[model samples]
Target: MTVLILGGTSEAVALDQLLADQAPEIRAVVSLAGHTSDPKPLNLPVRVGGFGGIEGLRHYLIENRVVAVVDATHPFAAIMPFHAEAACKAENVPLIAIRRESWKPRPGDRWRSVPDISAAVETLGKPPRRVFLTVGRLELPAFADAPQHHYLVRVIEPIGDRLPLNGVKVIQQRGPFEADEEEDLMRREGIEILVSKNSGGPATVGKLTAARRLGLPVIMVERPPKPDVATVDHIDQVLPWLVAQGIFVTERGV
Candidate 1:
């Protein structure tokens, strides 16, 4: 059986690796959105770029004989999941979503949750003097109208083009950053407000802690609902499930 993974996030990478290691008999392919400058290498075969749309994805699945699809894209990757769901349904292919759990406010955490970026912006009230934007490059456009605030935007890749906001400062960096570093950055930048997606992972959790420590209000955009599919939160759960479904004979280390 062949499996196609709609991928980009670290969870996708881990899932691909786990599948390869545990189910070598099953052909696995990772599909990247090609939005990042330097995406991590995958252990299995990969396909980059959008699958056009639902129709295109269905065509690819039919042509490639992909029996199953594992959507491990970013939680806020709204359109891709919709496309995947439609394509899989049309093609009659089994589908699953590996969604990372959203982060909740802890005992000391001060978070202002909003359903979307627009709502978050509204909740911010007036323009903050100094804002740390941890939202990805794609969502930066939403903040263009809020140009009165000085933005310290951090991204994994260097933004080649100028942002719509005049006072935007870009920082190109990957995560798993230390809490101390985040705190120091907040201090140095004189950040009074933080805007971030509630992307729950160790890589970027430091920012949340930093915001809490400095008593800065964070406009946390809530994650979207996972696509309708058999879902799992961890890689270990997937292998056994696949085996039970007769997708693989036994665990074959990749």
Candidate 2:
């Protein structure tokens, strides 16, 4: 039986690893949106790029005879979750999402939450301040309007000429960064504010911690609403769900 995973996150990698080790009989494919130029290798077969839309995805599901789908896209992914929900329902396939929780402000966090990236730009106002941007390369264009501020952009992939800012420096790096390192970067760069999406994961939470230590104001872009579907926060729960669907075989006979 075939399973399709809408993947791009660390959680997706973990779930794929679990399936590879524990359920060898279940054939799984990991689908990426092709954002990262050099994504790390995975155990399962990986398909990069889009599935067109709902109609295209629906066709792929029917053609592949996929028994299930796991939506493990990024938290800020605004379209794919809805498309997956619609396509899976049409194909009569069991679908589940690994919806990671949003980060909440702690006692020392000086956060200013905004609905979206545009709002975050507006919050920066007319005054020029050194800003550290961790909201990915795709969202960088919106900051062009606020060109007065110096921006330190950290992305996994090269930004090229996407962000047309007057004073901006791009650092291509992937992370599970430490808080002390993050603090040092902020201090050295003279970052006055931080602009980040509420992409809740342990891999990149150090920036928030460092911001708290430095008492830097952060412009937190809240997550967009995800499609209402069967969801779990942890990757551990996925195998049991797959077993219950009768797609995963277990030696313990779960």
Q: Summarize candidate 2's per-residue lDDT along 1-254 as a digit string, tens digits.
A: 68999999999999888888877778999999999979888999999999999999999998888999999999999999999999999888999999998899999999999999999999999999999999999998999988899999999998988897678998889999999999999999999999999999898999999999999999999999988999999999999999899887688989
RMSD per model, one decimal = 2.2, 0.8
Candidate 2: global Cα-lDDT? 0.93
TM-score for all predictions? 0.93, 0.98
* Model 1 residue 62 CA deviation in Å: 0.9
For residues 1-254, what per-residue lDDT tens digits would candidate 1 score against the true structure? Answer: 57898899888888877876766667889999999858998899988898889999999999999888888888889899989999999999878888788888877677888999889767767745788989888787777767678989999877656466677888988888999999999999899999999888788998988888988888899987756678888767777766666676663621
Q: Locate the minimum summed-lDDT window of 10 residues in model 1.
A: 245-254
Name the Cα RMSD for model 2: 0.8
Best by lDDT: 2
